[model samples]
Target chain A: LAKTTQPISMDSYEGQEVNITCSHNNIATNDYITWYQQFPSQGPRFIIQGYKTKVTNEVASLFIPADRKSSTLSLPRVSLSDTAVYYCLVGWRGGGNKLTFGTGTQLKVEL
Target chain B: EAGVAQSPRYKIIEKRQSVAFWCNPISGHATLYWYQQILGQGPKLLIQFQNNGVVDDSQLPKDRFSAERLKGVDSTLKIQPAKLEDSAVYLCASVPGQNTEAFFGQGTRLTVV
Candidate 1:
């Protein structure tokens, strides 16, 4: 498993876009960058996943640089309801089949 | 259409007591996982099962914790002689396969005194 480092917390206002970046200096070639959003008292929800370049979904976008050493999760038009903890996971597609979640970045969306 | 299910949302027990938690994965999901999350920390994988076979349990305290997934469907995690450090939320998750996303239950919160 590749260890990831991300901000502890970030603050954003309504209608603004929020971007959270994660650094994985020792990422493996077979590893994928995945992001999950977790609300209070709820399970973490899959936001987006990418192996490289960019991938977008109905909820968010993932941007991975050419080196694949880091990735960013971009959320469009933030709202108060978007306040949650964001997790960046770097793991191989298969193998252990375990998710190693770190102390996620807490995003606070204010009005 | 239903998601993963867990029973006994909360449990309070004294040290040296025994407690068990149950989990039912989503229909047709072959992979199940159990994780422990302490306050202000991310979930740590305790065990992983592919169908009825164990995949990984290196992090589990085998001396006191045991888990079984019989018939490759419902699973149970039991802890005997629980300690105060065992207080945390236990989350159960299931994924269809290595290529699919995982879904987690609300989790069982355990408090040991």
Candidate 2:
């Protein structure tokens, strides 16, 4: 499993865009980047995933550079409800691959 | 469809006591995982099971912890001689197959006094 490092905390206001970057210096060729959002007292929810370049969904966008050493999760039009911890996971897709989580980036969206 | 289900949302026990938590994954899900999440830290994978067979349990404390999925539908995790450090949330998650997003259940919070 590739270890991930991300900001411990970030601050944002309503209607602003939030970008959380995660660095995995030892990412493997077969690994994919996946993001999850976790609120207090609830299980983490899948946000988006990508192998390289950019992938967007109804919830968020995942951008992986050509090097694949790092990726960014972009959230548009943030609101107070978006306040939660975001986790970046790098792992293989199939064959019962294990997914490990880091400390995660805590996004605090305010009014 | 219903998500993963866990029982006893919270538990409190003394050191050296034993406790068990139950989990029922979504119907027909092939993979189930158990994780321990400490306060202010990310969830750590304790074990993974595929159709009632163990796949990974290197991170689990074998001497003190044990988990089983007898019928590949429901599972249980037990901890004996619990220590103060055992206070954490136990999470259960399941995926439909090898290639799919996992669905997690609201974890059981355990506090060892």
The whole-model lDDT of each prediction reads: 0.91, 0.93
- Per-residue error for B11 in candidate 1, Å, reads 1.2
Q: Which residue pairs does candidate 2 place in steric collision?
A: none
Q: Count the backbone clashes (under 3 Å) in each candidate.
A: 0, 0
Candidate 1 per-residue C-alpha lDDT over A57-91 given as tens digits, one digit per residue, 9 for 90 to 100: 99999999999999999999999999999999998
Task: List model 2 lDDT by residue over B53-108, tens digit each.
Answer: 99999999999999999988899999998999999999999987866477899999
On TM-score, the leading prediction is 2
Candidate 1 chain B worst ten-residue window by lDDT: B95-104
What is candidate 2's CAPRI-style docking category based on DockQ? medium
DockQ of each: 0.60, 0.69
Backbone clashes (count) for model 2 = 0
Residue A55 displacement in candidate 1 (angstroms): 0.5
Query: Considering summed lDDT, which 10 consecutive residues are worst modelled in model 1 chain A?
Result: A91-100
Specify the poorest-scoring 10-residue window by lDDT in model 2 chain B: B94-103
Maximum-DockQ candidate: 2
User: Across residues B1-113, which tens digit of lDDT does each residue of candidate 1 receive?
Assistant: 99999988999999999999999999889889999988778888999999999999999999999999999999999999899999999999998865547788989999999
Question: What TM-score does model 2 achieve against the real structure?
Answer: 0.98
